[model samples]
Target: MNVNHSNITITESACKIADEICLPDTYLPRVVVIGGGFAGLALVEKLKHKEVQVVLIDKNNFHQFQPLFYQVATSALEPDSIVFPFRKQINGYKNVLFRLAEVEEIQPSTNTIITNKGNVHFDYLVLATGTTTNFFGMDSVESHSLGMKDIRDSLNIRHMMLQNLEQAAITCDDKERDALTNFVIVGGGPAGVEMAGALAEFCKYILPKDYPEYPSSIMNIYLIEAVGELLGAMSDKASSKTLKYLKDLKVKVLFNESVSDYDGSLVTTKSGKTILAKNLIWTAGVKGQFPKGIDEKHVVRGNRLKTNFFLMVEGYKNIFAIGDIAALISKDTPKGHPQVAQAAIQQGKWLGNSLLKIIKDKPVKPFEYKDKGSLATVGKRKAVADLGKFKFAGYFAWLLWSIVHLLSISGFRNRLMVGFNWAVSYFTYEKSNRLIIRNFKPKSLVNETEE
Candidate 1:
């Protein structure tokens, strides 16, 4: 049978080889994909009709749209709108199976993964395990700060913000009430910037109407960044514009500032100034979510696995890594590609195609990333977009950002729901996910930075 070289090809010989494994009493070459994040999902999707036996696994059942995680934290969009089921994402793919399991360790030499459930033997291993919030080894900060990585983390912050307002309303002591009303967000990334803007909007426009019992003016939102500016990855124009928008919304923007310490209620800055706040959200740093058995020395800067240009983990042939977990040791990206969804998705797609070629005994091409730029939404009708040659900031940029993200979301339902929420929120200047369905208890909070 003749085969076209244009489309991705899995050779008839490779197909026959894969088919032999599906035969009874024979060991099949299993391709195990760990962490069902953007990278893992994209990889699995691309291998839908491939010959390999694929297994996709993650700690959580649903794949989170991490870019809009801050929106969930600030109650701009509900958790449902940003999360989609992993099984549903890979449904009807006979070659693929989904597993909800936390990986304990990766034994690359034996091509095995030891998870909480059991050990999985693999012919080809993909470590798309992603990353975890980094507290920079500060236990005090780690224990007290709120992170927005998952739905639970987002909902926890949501509860904390609402609970703080409720507590402030009833507190008779002036100092205690003041502490309850103050929110300190650490880091100047998109999450911190967006959260600060959202909190300010809530206090400025929404809080007074919702909590008439308390003075909305008393609520203070502080965005502290160690760097000199916000959105450090974006263009200077975008960064400056976002800073202006945030300040205009009444968010106290502290530049070149770092949180030296936090004792649950007070945030002490590097400059020796202390801010009293019951809520301290950490959007500071993230490290790779490496499994247990991997040698700690293999983890380089940002706790990422050192990989080659082809995204293969160092010292291993069949074992590969992508997304937040993989660190390409190249002159171009000496550290690694930015741990963004686009990088992960692209790498995943590339890996899927490369592996198919390898299985068919064809030369595998080295992966090269095509930069598509970056964008971040600050608040209602305010955003910044940096499209390499073309950079713009403001309402038009915000509209573009919304459209891009809405289309990029995994499921159709999520896109529709998020689109609807945005339209309604834009028209009324109101967010629908503001209801406090459950009271937040400080003791019930789980640290999102648990590694």
Candidate 2:
């Protein structure tokens, strides 16, 4: 028989069904949220005291603060500062249960989710699975290049970065060392820009001290973008200023060019130019990630799950899609809302309220996204922002960026730790921690990209 809340007696089979069988029966309608990302966490927070029985499941048990992932990669912040334990996050919620399991498929017809651990039935199913790195079928680039989508991805880049330098320091061969020192970054979104800037700062301040044997000139940083501009989603002010800031930092900005291919060593662009680098970071694009079973009709651009105005998956009564995974296509939002933390947080809270109305038999309101604005920080004391009408960059924007990011970080201790790290770096022109805690070996992009 299939496993479910109805079967209170624990199973002794190999799949460890006992892990879930112990959950106290609340006798309330079960709501299964697949993902512990911003949206899923927000939803669970709202459903905490509500009548619903919330089952929050994710491959990882923590709620990772994604916006700061680049910081983690650059070693400006550690992993623990960004990853909050799901159990601790929902400490007091007696109605909610947390599970760490990889979902294999969603059998909507039977109202069941099949995971590696077991099968779970749900009265309402929420897919806040978020997005995965998109290579757009570039076999070579996907295989050779690095992507930073989560904590694991960030740590991979971090370890590889220091490891490459360490390897270069010991290697006698010139070509190999040059390849190690050369850094090529694809995509000029917040991730790429921030990474490029952080790398530039490292090259300027940290690398010189860390590796005095290698000349600062030997280390080169390149920020390549396909479009003629960077920060394509923001205003002209941000785009123009950031480009100038990057140029000031000595980061080679390649505009109107896209990486055509990479063969583990050489990076060739569409313009026929080539760069030799061992470290190739691809922050180019991302597509929605979800388990199998959803039909193509409900899938749209960027491989996102299509939902109605109310955030419900089209043609499914109890299934809802939200956050980066959800593409709420409308005349106003042709391509769907920008896949940012704001969109996810808003949609999650909105859906949570809507669900309360659902259980209370009240009117369900449609979701409408409010674009707060966008912010991207470049080198030290350099940043840009675009509010609805006001567009600003430089010192004040930089200050705002620091404050906003610190506040937005998950925990008080995290914010304090990050702040302390920043202060030390600024005052000393040095970073205290830069360790290859884990030896990073690149994973199979084919298997890793999808999850």
Please tell me which predicted candidate would have the highest TM-score against the true structure.
2
TM-score of each: 0.91, 0.93
- lDDT tens digits, residues 35-57, model 1? 88889988988887566778887
lDDT of 1 at 416: 90
Residues 1-451, model 2: lDDT tens digits: 1123343322345245553333445467889999989899889888887777889989998888887788788777788888888998888776778988999988899998888887788899999999999989998888888888989988888888999999999999999999999999999999999999998888888888889888888888999999999999999889999999998889999999999999878999998999989899999999999999988888998999989999999989899998999999999999999999999999999998899788667998789899988899997899999988989999899988888888987778888888998887777766647988867766554457678
Q: What TM-score does model 2 achieve against the real structure? A: 0.93
- Candidate 2 displacement at residue 124 in angstroms: 0.3
**How many steric overlaps does candidate 1 have?**
0
Error of 2 at 189 (Å): 0.8
Model 1 scores a TM of 0.91
Error of 2 at 437 (Å): 2.1
